[model samples]
Target: MELKKKPTKKDNFVFLFKGSPLNDFLYPFKKAANQWVARYIIVTFAIIIRCAVGLGSYSGENQPPNFGDFEYNRHYMEIVTSLPLYQWYLQDLGNSNFMLKFPPLYAYHSFIWGIIGKLINKSWFELNNSIGCQDIDLKSFMRITVLFSELIAYIPSVIIYTRWMGRHYNKAPSIDQTIIAATILFLPDLAIIDHGHFQYNSFLLGIALIALNNLLYDNLALASIFFTLSICFNPMILYYSPIFFFYLLSLCFVPKFNLIRLIYIGVSVLLTFIVIFLPFIYSGGIQLLSHILYTTFPLNFNILHQSYPNFWSMTNHLLNNNIDLSNLKNLSIILTILAISPSCYAIFTNTSKRLLPWCLASCSLSFFLFSFLIDETSVLLPWMPVTLLLNEVDADVISMICWFFNTCLFSLMPLLKKDGLLLQYFVLGVLSNWLMGNLSWVRKFVNIIIPFISQRPNATPVLPHSYSWTATIISFYVTATIILSCDLLQIQPLVEIENFWEISNTFLSTISFGIFYVWLNFKIYTIHSLKAKSD
Candidate 1:
């Protein structure tokens, strides 16, 4: 009674490509089966892309006397391996350029990597002689060290976080979780900064993510330990310190004043710090601890801002050397504290784990926009929390995150340009936008314009409305075109201002960051209000 349906044209077309490499590669994903296979494949692709990007030039590739952070990292390893624990922070104090300013755990990490480098190539870690050294083998070894650090630390944390999210919140399916993890891993800023520009930011961020995950699981002691370790690894982790402190404090009193939990967390944190600093304390004394603190939080009063796109950079142009250094420093401290206080207050009042990422995003963005001595790389702080938010299926949240992520990358254009990473920057930016589906609108527009061209079936816009999205895309295009033209085409400034192009880039980025900061604070407040209603 039923006749078999004849294969249609679409079915015939699909059959023609069924055994092709692309179809075979996408089979697991298409079927949504064997999620682990798909995840492994995606992760492998991400790693290959990262390694390929690492093959490009790094910060200060050939510049001497002021070779950038890459050289600083290599030099720090040399100091750690060659010097005593007490003398680690004392090296090159007269030359601020070469001084060891990071925390002890960083030095310890460098020491480990340095020993490995020594084993691989004896000359790579040679003290004093290694300064400004640019051997190809040495470069490869150093780049591998960063990649290895991410594998052991960063990537694992992301996998664990996504697994937890899949089990709990939204109960996202396995394939969806894998895609989310891959998106975070493909985040262009982290890859370009760590792999191309060279830093151990991912290692520190991974520890911080693990700490946040522990906090979510109500493992207070473990959370404290990992968070303390994160801070010990990099003082930049201090940006998230206020939120962590307030959240934990809220836990102590909200249900009831639980003295036992308080003591447990306090002891865990104190012990973690003690263990990290024990070697230095034993080698030197409490004075050494003071010295370490001083090195970690040095107040550079000379420069208003180091070309970082923030409140200070914008003001620096306006003030034009008229501002007093001491007064401006105090003002910056006050403003930063005020800016972060509301987020801290929200977390303390709400004490809900769901609000943690929003609070963290608000607090860290506050610090990046308002704090003194900010670095362009500090944008990564807020970005870490924002990336965690991708677990939500909210369209508004996803759209805002895509916009903010692109803004963060744009803020680093001057630095990337200075380091000869413009090509890598452009490539990674396009790749990230494509992965996020932010470029779907452009693809749709292309098909509309061409009329006869076939549109891709999967090309769906991430945002529902195209009007606002199109406006944003056009604004970014115009500004980026202008800035690149001015810098690359060597167009002279209309006004007689030194570093005009750099200043203009910084100011424009500051405006963008300022808008996002305001929106983020409002969003945090809205989240808290809704949470209160539910409670």
Candidate 2:
């Protein structure tokens, strides 16, 4: 018979996970408080962090000619709340210039929130007077909206999903589920973008999470409905639609395929679209709806979204900015389809719930990497699936995700800095790192100053001693340092160049994201091959 060694108190400190040392320092508190208390504590901490970040400047603090996304969102609310249903998307006044570019569901959501905003302060939605509004009460109201959305929708969705997955798979303990849920809620990019940068991303993401939760429960019809709702709220969620399409279609091929379920899902989706769009059709006819569709998926912009880190962005920069990919829109669409096809195929072939998140990440990342005219904020999309994998998975996977999280933050450095969010970035980054046990590596540097705190072995080493891995780690760190130095020192551009720091950051981010893209593709291919061999 095999003998098992007894777990020491130190091992008990890592009880949130079995035989894992991640966040060992937090174990004492976990032990002291019950699971519910610990979960609430983490949720409260996440909310507090968001509220703290809300104090920073928003997208366009005082800019006049045309403000940034903050002003655009305010305009959206004003139109949705004050304008007639048909006229909401067609508002062309100077102050109402942003108009309702999003789908009708999001417009209705904004309408409700705008009513609340009006209740708080009448001037907030007072048509032209609300233009470029930046009062403290307005800011507070906006922040509260995001927080409330997250609290009511996103946080609960993630927690329920994680707990459901844990129970279904029996993969890890309850504490691990709570930790994963909390960590997903505490992701810095989501908090920074939604709360600090000012948007309704968490709400959209929450709806998507609920869709995935329904999928986990094998409630395919509800999953389809929830996903339809998500896409209506933010059409960008369609980036993952291809994989979902194949996955759901594959389900129809399973044994004893239920025609009733299929019809139910189809009707649910059709009714949803009808309910949201029928009013618009009644008010303004198909032409107004066509115009709304045109604005939602605008194609006039150039390939790069102001040097966003993507394939076209880097390619254009490398070719001395002479290549006009705007002329190759058809080719761009073709390549994006090609890039995402493999992952969709994998998901279709696998059709396993365990592989869903990975396949989702793969497809969404392919879109982010190869699709035309993606923004930095869209990083949160791929991150949603990746973040869902932060349970007691492989340590290497966890470490890779940690690095990717940091890369996502670094990629948005220029945007974050422009919005005066540097402090939030630094503080939240450190806190998230500490929470994930990524800061254990800091003990090595800390031991150089204070020796006692460094004795515990790192649960996840920052870098392996292998040549390729070490080189990659060192190069990434060096690149990050250079980018930070360039930003902090306000490096002046050469005579021929403008915003050189931004350009460099964009280039580096593109390279890092490209590496990750390759890794994801490789993972998808490997999983498919292994499964094929097993079959």
Candidate 3:
């Protein structure tokens, strides 16, 4: 027999026996702390760039220099210990104005942030809502608050990402995972909330991803709570119930299981369903989930109508009267059909190891297909990229596409916008927002808030001084370089990138990234296959 290499210190980890109770308890915490310390750069970068995108760029008020957090922040105050949750939730004013009230999950999240924000400024509410730059510049407070809150938000997700990385077969630690975690954890759309119109998705999205992971691992109770919480925030997750249900079916019927596994699966499903349905059930005391929640599937916000309150509406409104909802329905079906091609194959043929990736890919395709022909609901498209990133799997072309798009965004946005192409930016935002703002109600508020806040903040007038074409050129090049470096990473695709030219540039980069990723995947697969045969 060929000599087996001795286990090295590099491969030794706290989680070599992580399944044990002592190890599980210690490792997840230790891994979390380590990842927290090690991932400082990625996390910091994720927070700061997103902050600049808000502070340096503009807030939803597009108030050139304004970055207000909420409309009635004064009433509820920022998340602080002084206020009671009941008081925060029971508030009457900020609800519909910002659409923060409807989604139960996000309202709760805002409760937490409001408490923290209140503690920070004591009158951050006044600073945010009232028309005056407080003891600090609107820009500085705007940037600092977003950066600080987001940093606070990351505490839980780093824990989750560390657990995920530690779960890999070799129990390896990856900087790649840290980087991807940072991207998901510091979603620019949510991070920009303080900079513009942020709601509760920032930290909660991580919880959603964790819930998804737990569901696949057959941890139903926690997953159900998370999924429910996620849905409470965005409500669009209710659409994903079909995915979850089908997954439950596969777990129950498709997989052959031992008695314990079967018991585990059964309890997981029952507990998850009960937990997810718990809130509505308590309200009605016997609310029919099939009628109240499931019936609202394929939610119709005039999705077929071009004027259908899409992400692109603020930038430019279009009237496409000829289409019907049936058309959107048909289109989503066709797109779903397209998505199933590779995804179904991967799921059925790939080994158990591929389940997470397959599920994510399928969900992403369903979302994408829905966006493509569903009139103007396309703003939800960027979520496809974000959701796919959580899968933590990539191929050559996909990686290249991600990188190329990122490069194109910074390099391309100003050039195209300067040339009278707000439409292109709208499409990008539509897709980005759609993907990132997977929660519909959250998306709706942002759709209104960003533009609503576009005017100058009356309190402190910072004139709208976008980079002059010259300044833009210099700044954009620097931005493009940083983006290019990440593109080289290609952990997530460039749907997050800004404009058409950027997308085109990203497409070009994808061509290169695809080649490299393919080679790498091939090398790994070949080695694995050989090793398997040898064994």
What are the Cα lDDT values of the candidates? 0.81, 0.77, 0.42
- Which candidate should be chosen as best, given TM-score against the real structure? 2
lDDT of 2 at 146: 83
- RMSD for each model, in Å, please? 5.5, 3.1, 15.2
TM-score of each: 0.91, 0.92, 0.52
- Write down the TM-score for model 1: 0.91
Evaluate model 2: give its TM-score: 0.92
Q: Which stretches of candidate 3 lie over 4 Å from their true place?
A: 1-36, 57-59, 62-101, 115-199, 215-218, 238-243, 257-298, 304-321, 324-351, 371-398, 401-535
Worst-scoring 10-residue span by lDDT in model 3: 456-465
Candidate 3 local lDDT, 223-275, one digit each (tens): 65676666665555443444554554445555464466456655754665565
Best prediction by lDDT: 1
Query: lDDT score, residue 222, model 1?
Result: 97
